[model samples]
Target: SLDGASDNETKSESGVPEVPVPADDTPEVLNKALSGLSSRWKNWWVRGILTPAMISFFFIIIYLGPMVLMMIVLCIQIKCFHEIITIGYSVYHSYHLPWFRTLSWYFLLCVNYFFYGETVTDYFFTLVQREEPLRILSKYHRFISFALYLTGFCMFVLSLVKKHYRLQFYMFGWTHVTLLIVVTQSHLIIHNLFEGMIWFIVPISCVICNDIMAYMFGFFFGRTPLIKLSPKKTWEGFIGGFFATIVFGILLSYVMSGYRFFVCPVEFNNDSNSFTVDCKPSELFQLQDYGLPPVLQSITVKLYPFQIHSIALSAFASIMGPFGGFFASGFKRAFKIKDFANTIPGHGGIMDRFDCQYLMATFVNVYIASFIRGPNPSKVIQQLLALRPDQQLHIFNSLKAHLTEKGLLPLLEEAA
Candidate 1:
């Protein structure tokens, strides 16, 4: 079957195998049901049916809670990595290259171990400190990560063949680049998740809303092409998606901000031996009244601070997010292929669905660090708990003296 699949592949002008054009394997039942419709309408129907199914499944994951959602993100990350690497494999016709696939996966594991190790140390510091082996690993996490990466690097060097040096090195670079794109971005997504489910959900929801609204507008009113790479993209869609995403993001943030379950940061609960999302929500999620602009000075508006921030998130999603998709389109064109792989009936592969998401995740992470995140008191307390008793007492006295000088210590004591 492998041989048959390879034989069917198209060769490029350089004699390298091009990725095969993905066959439309729409389910037979859908095909029969839509047989009377034109191909254009048939495609719309297929995407319409499958997109909601995907969205519903996504909501179900969210409802199931963060742990399951995290597992799903990881699985999607792996799938996206596989799709990209598989393309590289076909393009280079490296099936005969010894251990190419194995090495790729090895590198993936090394990087994930490195990223997740840092995450555990940051979020689950207490749990990690309680376990001797985990404590050691966390302390030496960077060293361990570097050593693991070096092992893979050495293996790759050792596996290099005499005449196949160039091709092997190309594949090596390909593997690392894929890791940077898929793993690094997905890691950021998880980081955003721990901040709050809203951080994870609102941005993703904006992107999805933009994508759907863009398609709808373009299908009905496309006149000018937006880019040469993606012929189907139109300015009409771009503009429509932008406005729709902004409104959707604001509304979504408003609704979610009111719920403690959505606004609270995810933290580990040692007593329950599980993760928990319960806290006095930060001011970002609290409603505040604001005087209207000069144009409407007579009116006042009450809004969550996050809703104002959502405009930034949505603006980037609508305006710049499509670039990610365009970049993937250009990559596909270079390889002379259609979709990444028909993993989704009408949506190509998991990577196709996520190209823009990776970009949005990066933006959201940076945005939070820049604008929303403040010095976390919990983290400070955790660090204090890890210090020696004398050191903790020393810092405590310093803080108390400073607060007393500011005339706040007596007030705090009286309140207590």
Candidate 2:
């Protein structure tokens, strides 16, 4: 019965003629027309030369400082949110749900308020406590966030039209998922940048390098397809990209490790009315001589510690990072769309460019937390100094009592 149904057959209820679904099971044709030399050259001009030039211009913004970088990330987050929300709107446009767009944007504002509030409270707790208003807000950040979210929920319910109820709920779900994917990850990216620009720059650059090299390698020598999710990707490209990214990551890390600007965590210095990245660099960014294995000892006597970390970073960028892109490809394919948008001539939208970066950001954040991050005593002390005298004394007394109970204070008194 299924085999007898014609492609143009209509559904009984809606009487809408079904659009034929493209067969996804077929082996992709690698020798398509775009594989020709002229087309490839044109693609290279857009994707290779022009794209990198634009990226370099943004890198100048990055070089300016973390403040500029944060602004740029905020702008990018807005653009990406716009692009994704637009897709949802287009998909559900037929329903014409009342206030869906407005509610979606409202939800975005609420989520950003929550996420950025947490970031500020966590990182700039001292600055927040210095001002009475900020101190109050910081203290009640979560409660305020919940209240704002509940307001939006109430608004959405009130705005719901009788006929478009299902569509409105669908859009609501869509908006929330998009917010989680876009907002949450962008916040983590900012966290990575603040940790040290190296965490942000290195991981992102590795992905870019991998993308470029993979494209180049695939263009020339591609034969076997890599995965069904991304038809254009090839085994040759993946292999070439992996090796190239490893070398790039190591060299970049070595060069960046020598510079305090790249190595230092960003901090807002209120005394100077500016942000500062001036501190004794962490060991990861400092040179530590590592002994070579017996086989490699004759070829090279020693290596910097970061070179080993670079291998791991590059491996993730080259291997795991592209899976983000693969996931995006599958997402687009499911929607029967070509790209998220043609915002860039060769690339898609901001979301398209950042899909891999978000995944990389998540990985870098986890890596830092697990391996690099520790209890920051200096930061804790700074926060203590910022508190009111009574509050500071309270904390000090509490700490002393805890220490005394643990028997550490008695040992310290004996030593004194």
Question: Could you report the Cα RMSD, in angstroms, for every candidate shown?
Answer: 3.4, 6.5
Best by TM-score: 1
- Candidate with top lDDT is 1
**Candidate 1 local accuracy as lDDT?**
0.91
Deviation (Å) of 66 in candidate 2:
0.4
On the 0 to 100 scale, the lDDT of residue 197 in model 2 is: 86
lDDT of 2 by residue, 1-416 (tens): 43223211222123521223323221124224335557557566557645777678778987799998888888888899898788777765545668888988999999999999999988887688788999899889999999999999999989987545666776888899889888888899899988888888888899989988998899999999999999999999999999999999999888888888988999888777688999998677666666568877665434556667778889999999899899888878766776777676567677888887778878889988987799999778977887799999999899999999999999999999
The residue-level lDDT of candidate 2 at 124 comes to 81
State, as a TM-score between 0 and 1, how close model 1 is to the true structure: 0.93
C-alpha TM-scores of all predictions: 0.93, 0.85
